[model samples]
Target chain A: MMAGSALRRLMAEYKQLTVNPPEGIIAGPINEDNFFEWEAFITGPEGTCFEGGIFPAKLVFPPDYPLSPPKMQFLCEMFHPNIYADGRVCISILHAPGDDPMGYETSAERWSPVQSVEKILLSVVSMLAEPNDESGANVDAAKMWREDREQFNKIAEEIVRKTLDLPPP
Target chain B: MADDASSSSGITGNTVENSINQDELIMKQQREIEKEISETIPLVGEIEELQTLEKEYNEDPIYLLKVKDLSSKYKSIRRTRPDGNCFFRAFSYAYLERLLTDKQEYDKFYEIAKNSKDILVALGFSQFTVEDFYETFMEVIQRVGEHAGSTPDLIETVRMELHDKFNKQGYSDYIVVYLRLITSGQLQTDQEFYQNFIEGPRTVTEFCRQEVEPMYKESDHIHIIALSNALKVCVRVKYMDRGEGSQVIAHDFPEGSTPLVHLLYRPGHYDILYA
Candidate 1:
């Protein structure tokens, strides 16, 4: 039952994305036949360290869709506090529905079935503009973000340059 | 083939694997059983009748003493599923139970609840998503009032509908979900009064977006107060945790009013507490 609903929701979201694409964000499934795995390209939000970069990423939705949040990871290298070294986004919205057992997040900032893909992308864009160093997934990046601004920008700029390269389509 | 593979690994290995799988299966079943217990058992245990809690430690002697004193005051509790929606569930149950005694309050609540859908929609919740919860919430309220008699009968009926789990998505959690949204909306709408209590860096809008809107996010003091204010009813939350006192700290929501709904909040969970 959830599978049917999840698939239907994905289709609707896909339609919305295609019809009215958010600026600096374009996302869709890699395969026409499969809706579960999607590929996305997000242009770095202007006025951020990641500006002028087109970051490629992957989103893999669980069978439950909105009920369970999808996993988002950058295909390109990422150097940010909230994004893990391996490129996974670590925003509170992606966390499962419940209180932060660790007390890092308010219950409301976490996932609910009502959140859509567009919202996730929007949050990702905002996260890029202002990485929440308080609860950083990448400890190194978080430390640099908080303590050494110049170093953080240099590394981010380098990564941004690398992400601008076109991966084979 | 699976059995053969395990058996060929040797008897001791097979036993270890079997035990591991057994433990996992047992834990999984325990979770399901716990859910069932919450759904079916309206009341968990009488205060005096129950034994020492399985999780409490000797390090918290003060808490134990408080528990002892708490049991002396409140005799019983009605357990709601600890599914993060416990606040709304316990509040609704306790509030309705209170409403049974007063027609004026019940009518007032009924009218507000009837019109709450529009407010929820205005707060940006999709009408399609909220319609069932709104209807069922109203239906449950109306059905209980067909003829208000004893509190026991009303509670049993409310438990039946609330715990119906017919559409676990719609009945069990969604109704609670909508109730929470209403409370959040009310809080934001009346930010002038609520802004004083909201903590952390998030603004009222951001707080509602992150904390109040999400389903299964446990409710806080703010949530309780906002919900009470939303429905124009006061709530008394009995803090039964290991606090500095022998008596369960009872705080009335909206600060100074006599409360209609009473709940027991014990660190991450909420349940109904009776006088």
Candidate 2:
């Protein structure tokens, strides 16, 4: 019963997106019958190093959604300190709601169902601008970030080049 | 000995006859119950069919004649032109009302709304009302486009644009027309966009029917009216207590409140002294 309501809301959200779409984001259900799983394509932010990158991601919402946040993971390879080897995004907004065990985030910083894909993308853009080095999803990248700033930038630049299919910057 | 054997044989034959008689009686009773059950189906179907036909026929010329008679009784009542602003303010509630009661009435009204020229002029002023809604909606889109990067900025921009759009007197007239569809239950929120815009007014009516009907059950009308009236008071209090931000401007909400409306209202939100 709870799942039914969440499904309905998810469908409504899907419908809203299809009608009055936000820029730089294209998302819909994987299948007409399945609103629980959505496939989203996001264009890399304009005027950023990651420009021209067309990243595909998946959003899987739990049955008790709106009360719980969806899990969003990049299907495409993304090499960054904040992105894990498994392609899971590490951001404050996507974290489980409430106090963080490692004392990193406040309750307000965590994910809420009210957080739409638009908000999440915006947060990711902000994250790209400023990475949280303290809690690194990729330890090697974090080490590079802390130890050798130039080398870290080089590696990020290389990844961005590969993403855009251009020569290394 | 012979006489005793004969009498026993005779008694066995009588016992078999008695058993057959009992079986026939049980079979007869079952048939009567079966017959009654069989007869009820056609009778019930006929009754339901008649009721349906009766309703459809009521929309005929005879029914219109009865309506004419009723109207003649109240003929002295002048068809006064409603204040444009008042009409705009009342649209949502009235639209919601019509949406719940009869879907067809809203459909008929929407059919008349297909011509943008007719909708614009026939509604309140000259043939320009539909054009006005289009412009206002476009303005909202343009405002949203301006704040492309941030979520907070997007919300703020949209709200500001809506505030401007609604403040204009032309929009007040449009709101009434929009509400007329809602109250008539012709428009549903879930209808496809092509149907809503391209098809006649019925689509808008359907949108109201689908979107807002579920929010308030028929039994809850009195409570909803009370709540709406109380909301006015809340807006007033917010204006007086908070100063600058609490004006009940169209489409603008209290700052930083979530985009979604709080469907569940507490008792205090509606506590008002009604005469």
Candidate 3:
């Protein structure tokens, strides 16, 4: 039932985010009998335009984990303004407090069960270093993050040099 | 809903169209949580004595004379389950239905609800799941302190053991996360009188780690004054919004005290009323 207490609360938040690892994050479970599919990586948040990137994401969780709220994405290529132009991640604590049928977040900034996964990956590295172009969900990256600031740091430094040129699993 | 995986637009493209749109957003969040656990409405109900407010309000005769003067100065209500943890389950079922007939506040809330599991295992919890939510909240206050001489068998044995352990979904989120971890360990061990009633830039340990150990985060006024000063009781509340007249403005939470749960808030629910 309740998918075994949502797999022992995602194995106690994947054993406290693998023994306290929150600086430029890095997560777990691509599989360990699937503690509901996770992945994460994130590093970016140094001196913005995603200095020295890393990205790569996924998450999933909800066979009712922390009573629902977990579906981050960004398996790369995440042009912000609340992420989704594919790589989902539409913030507000991973939505789901009345599953916002577009009443753009309000149930006290959504999600409950005291949100986790290291506070949703430190609120997605402080939402890729602050993006919230007032409710955009990638409206062309919130009109290039509010009208082209040097073409939004040259397309977030070309998706942080294509996430440090992939290749490290 | 598999967290809205419309990993559709910017490719990460079709892995069977993102597993059939994450199985239709996990069946629309499992039919909206099986329609909110099939509408759970009772925890302490059946006390509804009066209500003819012009036939339950056939369009306001001035809000049916303010619900006929608030049912002649409050007489009955007890509801407790709007599911946003209705003011801490109607203030822990009206403080164990008024200590099931007040034997000195049921022996001072059963000696701090039976040593509130060493105050949540000395503020660390996980001693076998907060000792199974402090042994089902001390077997529901020791079956209301062993039916303190029958207040209807201590409200029918704490309403059939709080409806069989709050309908058992991990023991109802370990009984509201063990009363929101004993109201966030007494509001972060009383952080300077609750950090000036936390208005902004949060800190009572980040509002008790995001609005008090968060099961169904709704209670406000700093979670009803940190759950009425962490179970010393006293609640009052009485608001009923859409204000300006109809004088039901109450308020009492440790200010000019008069304890004994009384809720009925109305703007974002909370029930139990009985005067």
Winner by DockQ: 1
What's model 2's TM-score?
0.37
Residues B71-148 of candidate 1: C-alpha lDDT, one tens digit per residue: 776666666667677787777767766666676787888889888999978878655445555766787678656544
TM-score of chain A of each: 0.92, 0.82, 0.39
Error of 1 at B232 (Å): 2.3
Query: What local lDDT score does residue A105 receive in model 1, on the 0 to 100 scale?
Result: 44
Q: Which stretches in model 2 have alpha-carbon errors above 4 Å? A: A99-103, A165-169, B1-275
Candidate 2 docking DockQ: 0.01
lDDT (tens digit, per residue) of candidate 2 on A88-146: 87776665422132324332255533345566776776666566776557767766777
For residues B103-185, could you state the per-residue lDDT of candidate 2 as single tens digits?
45334433333332343243332222123333433333344344433466555555444444444433432343333322322
Task: Report lDDT (CA) for all predictions.
Answer: 0.73, 0.45, 0.72
True contacts kept of each: 0.30, 0.00, 0.17
Candidate 1 TM-score over all chains jointly: 0.66
- For candidate 1, the per-residue lDDT at B99 reads 69
Q: Best TM-score goes to which candidate?
A: 1
Against the hidden reference, what TM-scores do the models get? 0.66, 0.37, 0.34
Please give, for every candidate in the order listed, the TM-score of chain B alone compared with the true chain B: 0.73, 0.23, 0.30
Candidate 3 lDDT by residue in tens digits, B1-275: 45445545456435644565566678779867855773765544556664733476778666666666678788777665666677877777667767777778788877876776787667665454455456656776676677754667556766677656655565555557678778887887788988898887767876776666656667788778876787777788888666777766778897787868888787787887888
Q: How far is candidate 1 from the true structure (C-alpha RMSD, Å)?
A: 9.5
